[model samples]
Target chain A: MDFERLYRDHADTVFGYLAFKLQDRQIAEDLVQETFLAAYHGLEQLEGVQSPKAWLLAIAHNKLVDFLRRSRNQDLPLHPESLEAASSSAPSKLHMQEILEQLAEPERTIVYGLYVEGLTCRELGEILGLPEGTVKSKAHYARRRLYQWLQEGSAV
Target chain B: MSSEEYKELAWGLVYGTLSAEERELALHLVSQDPEFLEALKMELELKQRLAHLKRAMPEEAKERVYAAITGSRSQVLVTAVLKTVLETTLPRMLWPVLQILERSVFAGEQQ
Candidate 1:
């Protein structure tokens, strides 16, 4: 299945999504390997599938969730420099991250998929196992929620 | 439509996912509705802020993953070779030696 090609194509996007979701670079790195290994083993199933990128993303997302579940239900830790960013400069960046951390599961994933990963609604739906309409609706809700939180200066 | 509905429309506009008709409606709202404009502004700001959070994969991490992929293939090859030797050759070759060693060790202990 030309694993090298697949890795070269999707590795960065997968890693970026994981980093954004987990907010932990080290853990994201480990999970990236695991995700690729899983994909390699499942190559037969992936043959002729629509949207292979979403397929890879779905695997990465599941890996991230499984890791979170095993890790004692830990909250998403802020970035290491979050405090420094908050105090020294780039408070808005830290603030946005904190707000993202507070978002519920699908919403947070939705927002990350939409804005950060630049996934289309169809791709997002495929990765999330939701219908396209549902993805769009969730994206709408997530966008509204984020906007509302930013407007209120508090987590929604 | 209600303000909340307009806000949802505003989201579609900002995301560039709105249909042509929907975009027209949203644009009209943006022109006339202060809340919708504020919502649009917030959406744009959020996108910009979130852009700051997009991180590239560290180079070391990329190297580590590539190494792991290569290592996994190597491990599979080694396992297959070891399995072939163990299943077909090692049991016959080692059984007699193992039995002899076992007898020698336990024989002295019993004595």
Candidate 2:
């Protein structure tokens, strides 16, 4: 199924989502491997899939959820301060991270999928297992929150 | 439409999730309603800022994924070749040496 081409196309997307969510490049890289390996095994199923990027992202989202669950079970800090050192030092990236930190899950994932990954609401709905309407509402709320925050930040 | 619904439509417009009829409604509101116009403008700005967060996967990570998928096969091939060399060629090559050693041991014992 030309798995290499698939990976080449979506590796950044999968990694970006993981890195953004986990805030740890090393762990994100590990999960990227897991996601693609899982995809590799499921290559036959991918033939009829409509959007390969969204499909890969769904796998990535599940991997992240599993990792977070395992982490919670182990009592590991989900967002380690030390991991921030591993992220980009650019101001815009730091700012973006600061803004995203204010959001909770599903909203965070939706906003990221819609704005950053450029996925449609329907695609995000499929990935997040929520109805399209729910995704749109969450996106609306998240955008308003971000707008308010941006206005406040600018005021300051 | 309610302000909340317009807000949702504003976001839908920005994300390109709006249908033809919904998009028509959104644009009509944009022209007629100042609040909806402001909301649409904010959404566009927010979209741009959020898009700035997009990051490329590191080269090392990409290489690692490639290696992980291919490395297992390469490892198996290498193991099989080494096993064949050790089991077939090594034993065959060492048989004459073993015979020479055996004769030397017997000669020494007889002496």
Candidate 3:
């Protein structure tokens, strides 16, 4: 795989996923670097890999999980306010973030991955280590909840 | 099919994850069931709205990744400069020479 091209294509997506999950720009940025660096090292294996974006995102997800685990052990603050602070000037983003915040884990990630990142259910299943049927079900429930909330105008 | 089954199929349809048979079933449900149609509409709308929430990686963060990949900030800067030269300045500078060479080749062919 052409590493530079892959980075150009999916860096924003990987970074966005990390930033959304971590809620901290600096940590997300660090993780982005690490993710790409790991991809760079694994370039040979990436040959013939379909859906490089999903592959990079799976790596990013792993990185986020590791960061979360380490943070818990180290007592590091994830800086949830960072997302708020970053999006303070953009109400639409802040509003979206608020709505996303209302979702539970894995579902929140599933919704963001499927809708925002445009990842396939199979890709999400691979990334989240769940069966495709389970990913679809989670996505179904998450979408329904979001739809009901939006319809009620409660999340607006 | 159960309501849950129909909803799962609807989700599969939204994500394009359904097999041919599953899709046919979902479409059949969409035609026959008003509730299924409504759910599909809402799901599609939610997908559209959520798509708009995509975030761009900040320029600084992108630079960090580039630097990390390329080894250092200075290396990235140098690579960027070299790429610009190769893509733009060098091509323009060599254009006259290339034109002259082409003309010479044409003249030789004529002779």
Candidate 4:
């Protein structure tokens, strides 16, 4: 596989997904390196995968899960404040991000994967290891939760 | 279905993820209820707001990543550390956390 080409093609997507998940630019940047490094070493296994972008995303997803688990073990909480702190006040982006940070997991992941990354319910199901129906249900609930956040001007 | 359930269905309609039968239910409800229409509008607006958050990877981070891929490990590690140190505008509260993060990273590298 052409590693340079893969990095050029999918790095933004991977980085974006990580930044959304981990909500830290610095950490997301570091994890992007690990994700691509793992991809480089695992290129042989990727030959049969149909969507290399999704494949890269799944790698990024796992890297994030592992990173979070490790951080948890080390007693390092992932701070929504830090995510906000890292960014300048780009209002719409900040508003969307603050609401997303308010959302519970799986829901945050669901809505973000759907709207931000433009992943379909089927694709999200595959990445998240849920059935498509379950993914759709999560999307529904996530939107309601988002709407509620909008109405409240704060998330519950 | 309950009103809350219908609102959720409205979300499915707005997101285009509803099955045909689900879409039928949602449209039926949507045609009847002003609340459902409002919900659909809100969902669409939320989607638009999310679209605004799109950001490309920065050049420095991109170079550090590619450097790691090409086996310039030590050089990129130094760059990362130097960048962190030289970055003068980081919020005061984030500094200690960044130090902890660096320690964890270096600790992982050693093992």
Instruction: State which candidate has the highest TM-score.
Output: 2
Task: Tell me the DockQ of each model, to 2 decimals.
Answer: 0.36, 0.36, 0.35, 0.33
Q: How far off is residue A124 in model 4, in Å? A: 1.6
Model 4, span B68-109: residue lDDT tens: 677764666788898767577787888889889889999999
Error of 3 at A151 (Å): 3.8
- Tens-digit per-residue lDDT, A56-148, candidate 1: 999998897788787757664545442232232466666677788887878888888877766777888878788999987787777767767
What tens-digit string does per-residue lDDT give for candidate 1 at B22-90? 999888878898978887787677667777666678677798898998799788789689757766876
How would you class the docking of model 1? acceptable
* DockQ-based class of model 3: acceptable
In candidate 2 chain B, where is summed lDDT lowest over 10 consecutive residues? Answer: B82-91
Model 3 misplacement above 4 A:
A88-96, B1-33, B72-111
What TM-score describes the B chain of model 4? 0.46
What tens digits encode model 4's per-residue C-alpha lDDT throughout A1-156? Answer: 588899999898998888877768888888999999899878887888777887888888888888988998999766556556546687656667677877787988888887777677777877877898998787877876777777886522
lDDT of 2 by residue, B1-111 (tens): 777677678878987878999999998988899989988887787777777567678898799777997676577579679757766766587878866876897799799
> Weakest 10 consecutive residues, lDDT, candidate 2 chain A?
A78-87
> TM-score (0 to 1) of chain B, per candidate?
0.50, 0.56, 0.52, 0.46
- Residue A31's lDDT in candidate 4: 90
Residue by residue across B1-111, what tens digits does model 3's lDDT show? 665566556767988878999899888888899988977876676676676556688887797679667775456578679757766766577877866876897799799
Candidate with better TM-score, 2 vs 4: 2
Encode model 2's per-residue lDDT on A26-124: one tens digit a residue: 788889999998998789989899999999999998998899899889986644463565556777666776778778888888888877877877899
